[model samples]
Every structure is written in structure tokens, then in C-alpha cells.
Target: MKFLRKASGLLIAGLILSACGQQQAENQTPAAANGDTVGLAISTQNNPFFVTLKDGAQAEADKLGLKLVVVDANDDSGKQAAGVDDLLQQNIKVLLINPTDSEAVAASVKRANEAGVPVISIDRSVQGAEVVSHVASDNVAGGKMAAEFIVSKLPSGGEMVELEGIPGSSAARERGEGFHQVMDAQQNIKIVAKQPADFDRTKGLTVMENILQSHPNVKAVFAHNDEMALGAVKALEAAQKNDVIVVGFDATDDAQAAVKAGKMAATIAQKPAEIGQIGVDTAQKVIAGETVESSIPVELELIQQ
Candidate 1:
């Protein structure tokens, strides 16, 4: 009887140990199953620029042996908020966001902050929240470059039309500011018409066409991005106004090809891929509890035929 009782006790002990081991395995983090996961929220993928940015981020994440979850906001602020919320449920270790609207994205940034998830802003900034880092090209300087290029083409000053990006975006505000800084200095150059095209190709075409009806004498055009610039080119071609010098930002593949083909006067090359890569790298640093700078600027260049 004593031997049987002792045997039963050992069996119960073994069962308890086995159950504890199974529970431990079940409670293991997802990172243990794969790797640390990072979330990326892009403003939109309609344009090739943002697509390249996403690709860059994904490649870097893969190289670092990390998992990346990408979400496209489609330029909708509410959608971006919901996307962020969804990513939060995935146990992401970090977040990299390219905001659709700088101010509107603040709410989502705040949520990430509250959840103790560090955020790294890419290409655009969040106005009301604290971000561990910001990675982007010098948009203000690029804007100044674009304006100067247009002035050089026109020389003695000519009426120009400006196709702006989405309202309330840092890219639009900074670029517009830089462009005006140059234009304000040169009394000979005047902006005949300026309107927001929301950084979209279709809107750029429609807006440029509308502006043309009012200011047919416009000598040059400056678009906040390549998408808009390409659209402007379409409008110019449709109107047979091929002589108008068009300057664009983001020397995307199409834009570079356009410049090489002499369809565009010039384009400011903002290495969007590099920006995306840096954003992910910075997020890793933040996750590892390493100190990082508040802002990191990517290089920019001017491309001409």
C-alpha cells in the first residue's frame, strides 16, 4: 500500500510539471515564434513614390530579421486612425508612420504613445505628438530648389502656376514656404495661380487645366510632387503649351524618365527609399532603448535632362 501511494504522488508531480511546461510554451511571445514585428502606416500607395518608400522599409526590415506589417491609409485620416488601432492589436514593437495629414495624424500618434509604442515619422511630421524620430528629405530646401529652377528658366520673371500638395501637410506647407521665399525675393517672378491638388495626378491635371483657362500666359509650373507634375505635363500637352517649364519634386522613375526625355524641365530628387530605410532603422534603435535624434534628413538632388 505504501509503494502504491508513493507511485501516485510521483505521477501527480510529473503531470503538474508537464502542464506547466505547456503553459509556458503557450504564453511565449510572438517574437519567439518569428521575430519582432514592426508596423508601417503609409499615407497612400496610389503614387509610385510611397510604394517605393514601403518597399524600402520592407527590405530593410527583412534584412534586419524583423517582421513588418504595412497599412495604407489611402490618404484618409480616419482610415489611418483605424489602421493604427488594428496594428496595436498585433503586438507590434514599433510603428513607422507617413502621415496623410500632419495635424490629423496627431490623434493616432497619441494613441501609439499612450500604448507605449514608439513612433518614427517618415516623409511627414506629426504636429501634436512626440515622435522618437523623423526621417525625410529637406522639403523646404527642395522647394527652394524647385522655385530657383523655375526662375532660372524664366530668367526675367514670368507668371507661374503652383500646384500644391494636400492641405495641412508638412510637405505642402514647407515646400510652399520655400518656394515663396525665392519668389518673394525676385520681384520679377509672380505666381499667377496657386491651388491645392492634394498631391494626386488626376487632381493635378484637372487643377492645371482649370488654372490654364484663367492664366493662359503662365510661363512655368511647379508641382509639389512628381504625380502632380506629370499631370501638369498632360494638361500642358493637351493645350499645346509644351514650352512651359515644369519643375517637380520627388524624382520618381517616371519623373526621371520624363526629365531624360525632355518632357520636364527638372525634378528635385528626394531619396524616398532611403527615407523609408532610415525610418525602420531608427525604429529599431528606439525599440532597443537606444537614444536617437529627433530628426534625420535624407539627401536630395536635382535631376535634369
Candidate 2:
């Protein structure tokens, strides 16, 4: 009876030990390996720029054999916060966020910080949280480039309209700052009208129409993005105002086509694909416990026909 009891005890202990060992093995797997995932939260995929960014990230992830989980906020800050929460629940190793509203995304970023998930900011930045890295084009510089181009076209100074992006976005603020840095100095070139179109083509069209109603003599238009520029182009065409020099940012395919067709005068080419690719690469380094620069800037160029 004693011998049978000893054998039974040993068997139970062995089974428990074996189960623990299996669990430990599973825990030891590297996050980039196996089915572990990283999360990508984008401001919106409606824009071709963001779609290209997603495609770039997806391509790099596939190359590295890493699983990437993507979420589209559709330009909604509330939806973005909820999406971040969902990604956290899925045990994502890292989070990549392109914020719709810089200030609004702060709370979500803070939550990720507290959860010990490293965050990488893409395209736009977060106002009130710590980020492991930021990957984007230099909006300020791009804006300066656009302004310089505008100056070249309208050296004698003229009335112009500025189509703004969404309120509270870092990109908008920085680009506006750079534009004003140059335009403010030019006493001859006056911004007759400035309005926020919220980075939507439809909104851009409506806003341009309203601005034109009052500022019919506007000589040039500088849109913070290509979508707005394209919309402004349509409005100008409709109103039979063909002489206005329209300079846009983000040389998306459509914008490039417009430039080539002489519809848009110029645009700043921000390589969003490169930004997305570098973002994933940075995430991999972070996952491997490697240090990375706080800001990674992709090069920009002025694209014109």
C-alpha cells in the first residue's frame, strides 16, 4: 500500500512539473516570432496617403514575418481611443498611432504608456504623452517649401487664400507656422481668406466656394494638403478662375496627376510610404530592446509639372 501511494504521488508531481514547463516555453517565445502581433492605428484610410502608408507597413511586416494588426479611426478621435483599447486587450507588443487630433489622442497614449506598451507616433504627433519614436515628414519644412514656391510665382504680392487642415493637428500647426514664417514677411502678399476644411475634399470644395464669393480677386491658394488643393482646383474651374496659382502638400498620385495635367501648380512630395516603412523598422528595433532616435524624418521634395 505504501509503495502504491509513493508511485501515485510521484506521477502527480511529474504531471504538474511538465505542464509548467510547457507554459514557460510558450512564454519564452519572442514577440516578433510566433503569432504575436503589433498594432497600427491610423487616422484615416480614406486618404490615399494613409492607404499608401498602410501598404508600406504591411509590406515590411510581411518581409519580417511579423504580424501587424491595423485599425482605422476614420478621422475620429473617439473611435481611435476605443481602437487603442481594443489593441491593448489583444496583448499587442507595441502600438503605432497616427492621430486625427493631437490633443485628443493624449489620453489614449497615456494609457498605453501606463500599460508598458511602447508607442510610436506616425505622421502626426501626440501632445501630452511620451512616445518611443516619431516617424514623419517635416511638415514645417514642407510648408516653407510651398510658401517659397508661392512667393516665386507672386513676387509682387497678391491676395491669396489658405485652406487649412483639421484643427488641433500638429501637422496643421507646424505647416501653418512655416507658411506664415515666409508669408508674414512678404508685405505685398496678403492672405485674404483662411478657413479650415478639415482635410476633406468635399469640405475643401465648399470652403473654397465660400471664400471665392468674398475674395474674388484671390491670386493664389495654398492648401495644407492635396485633397484640399484638388477641391480648390475644382472650385476655381467652376468659377472660371484659371490664373490662381494653387500649391498643395502631400504629392499623392491624384495630386501628381493633377500637377502633370496643369491643374495644380505644385506640391510638396512627402514620402508617406517611407515613413510607414521606417515606423515598422523602428518598432522592430524597439521590440528587440534596441535604442532608436526620437524623430525619424523622411525626405521631402517639391513636385511640379
TM-scores for all candidates: the values are: 0.89, 0.89
lDDT of 2: 0.91
Q: Each candidate's lDDT (Cα)?
A: 0.91, 0.91
User: For residues 1-305, could you state the per-residue lDDT of candidate 1 as single tens digits?
Assistant: 99999999999999999999999777754444457899999999998999999999988888766789999999999999999999998999999999999999999999998998999999998899989889999899999999888887887788999999999999999999999989889888888899999999999999999999999988899999999999999999999999899999999999999998888999999988899899888877776678999999999999987
Output the worst ten-in-a-row residue range by lDDT, candidate 1. 25-34
Candidate 1 clashing pairs, residues 3+ apart or interchain? none
Model 2: per-residue Cα lDDT over 145-217, one tens digit each = 9999999999788899999999999989989989999999998999999899988888899999999999899
- Residue 133's C-alpha lDDT in candidate 2? 97
Candidate 2: residue pairs that collide: none
Residue 83 CA displacement from its true place in model 1, Å: 0.4
